[model samples]
Structures are given as C-alpha cells and as structure tokens.
Target: MSVETDKIEIAFEQLVDIQNTIDTVLKVPKNPGHIGVRDMLRIIIGPQTDSDQEKLSEISSNFLARRQFKALLKSQTLASQTKQAAASSKTTSGQVRRSGDDFDLNLIPSTGDDKLFYMQLKVKNHERFAQISKAEMLFVESKGVFSSVPLPEILDGVSQIMIRQGHPVLDAFHDPEAEFFIK
Candidate 1:
C-alpha cells in the first residue's frame, strides 16, 4: 500500500482501538448506561498539554454554542428540492414543501446498547420556515466506541448525506450545551 494509505489505516486503527475500549467499558452490567459529555470528551481527547486541553475545551464550547438554525437552512434546501419533485407528481405526502420552526434539540444517550449516542433535533414546517432545517441523530462508530463526532464534521456529513439519501441521519451532534471555543 502507499504511504498515505498506511497512514490512514493507522489512524483508523487508533480510532477503532478507542471505540473498542469504550465499548468494553459500557458492557459492564449495572454500569450507568449514559456518560456525561465531559467524561466522554475526556476519553476522546485524552489529557492534552495545558494549552492543548484549553484549546479543546474552547473548541468544544464553541461547537456547543452554534445555533442549529444554520444547519437547519442547509437541510431545508434539500427538503425544498424534494418538495419540487413531489409537487410535479402531485404527491405531497412523500416530501415536505413547507418550512419548519427553529430546532427542537434533544440529547439522548444509549442504555443497554451503548454503542450509539443520539442527538435528535427537529424543526416543526420544515420547508416554509427555510431558516431552520432539522438535524437528526446519526449513529457513527469508530471501532465500536459509540459517541457523536464533532459538530462541523457532523454538519458536513449530514449535508452530504442529505444530498445523497434525500435526508440525513436520524441523530447527530449539533451545537453542544456549553460556552467555550477552541483557541
């Protein structure tokens, strides 16, 4: 394999290792099914250098602060397109043509099967509101560790999937619940 490919494989392996470790931890019976965001972040980021830790905290905080409304807009655009297609066929049931209200955010973690962390954000008339687009929870696993990825990456991934699959995942990370930024 090429050098670049090898590097990618290594990175993927590391992620997998992390995921597996978390999975094992979650497997313990009677263990709390849910972990706090702080604990989860610590496990993923590790103990950074003072500055690095500070930066991670800042980044996390900033991510949590972003308004899901922006994400909603991107989602709505596609919803509109689907509406157009449905309009042509006189089938309004398959697509949503009207925009919806701002996002209704919900943070949920797994219980028995702790391999997926779900964040469900819903916008009530998704097409007409145009200003808001609902972002559903997306289950992503790296080596079996179940947790949400970063917000920017999640948004980008959702946007791409919406273009490809007609909608995004059912759960994903959006603006988190915190006040910090990565420096």
Candidate 2:
C-alpha cells in the first residue's frame, strides 16, 4: 500500500474506534429492522468518547439542522450495515480536490482487492444496483477499512433512497401525543 493509503486507513480507524456513528449520521444503509425507544437510547448512550459524541452532535447540527434532528437522534438504532445497492461514487477528474461539490482528486491508492470476499461483495452490490429500477441505498466498499481516497462528509453529495414517509424508526422516538407525522 502507498503512504497515502496508510494515512487514509489510520483516519478511518480513528472513526471506527470512536463509535459507529457514521451510519446514524449519514442515515444510509438503513438496514431494515425495528428498535424500540429503550434499545435506541442504549446505543446513543453507549461507549463513545466525549469528543466522538461531540463530533456526532456537531455533524447533525451542521448539515442536518434543518431536519427534526432530535427526533432523528432519538430514532437511532445500534444496527450494523446490511447489503444495499445504489449508484457508484464519482472518481477524481484531475489533481484538483474539489470541483464544486464532487471531489475531482479522489486520490485513494489502488489495490486489486481488499479481500476476496469484500471484493465479491462490492461487485455483487454494483450489479444489484444496476438491476433495481429505483435503488435507494448503496453498499459502498472503500479501498479497505481505509479507502485509497479521502472521503468527505457526503450530505447532499450522494443521492440516497429518499424515504419521505418520515423516518420509520424516528416515529418511535417521538411522543405519541405531541408530534404528528410530517410537518
């Protein structure tokens, strides 16, 4: 692996070590399931560093402030990712890092396969997305635990399977008598 690849992996490890907040923050790979308020609370209150927790809070506040974040936060589950299919991520266009929104300089080191299983999984996901008429989620396999390129906070950068029905999990987070569905 290149020096750059090593650096990206280290950064990814830093994120994984902190907490599995990426899924919750990004609200992707929804991983079909149901968790009651009790379980949800446990995850949000689980073992995470103070700084990590703060980073999660800041992330929600910064990009997703417009949404009902408290409700969303309450809806968080301790779920791991399940396979989903979606479109591909954009690649580097040039040496430039930012060409408006998309990263033109997606300088992650190349590798033939991270592991055979993961590579097959990635290939299957890509193929599955191609078949789905309206694919909402994508199982993005980075170069490895550390991707070859630096991944940024993908808020509006990536399109998702937009669930406009007002998050199903978040419904449990709300007070039954207080909040109504949708604004």
lDDT top scorer: 1
Off by over 4 Å in 2: 1-35, 48-70, 74-89, 92-112, 115-183
Expressed as tens digits, the lDDT of each residue in 1-183 for candidate 1 is 699999999999999999999999888577332334554444333443334333323333444322232233233232221111111111233222211133333333344353443443344443433433332222222121222223323241222222112112222122122111110
lDDT of each: 0.33, 0.28
Model 2, residue 65: distance off in Å is 23
Q: Compared to the true structure, candidate 2 yields what TM-score?
A: 0.18
For candidate 2, write residues 1-183 as lDDT tens digits: 699999999999998966677656776564333334443233244433334333333333343331333354424411112222322233463111111111111212223343111111111223333332132222111211100111122233232122222333222112222121110
Evaluate model 1: give its TM-score: 0.21
In candidate 2, clashing pairs total 4
Best by TM-score: 1
Residue 99 lDDT, candidate 2, scale 0-100: 19
TM-score of each: 0.21, 0.18
Query: Residue-pair clashes per candidate, as listed?
Result: 25, 4
State the local distance difference test value for candidate 1.
Answer: 0.33
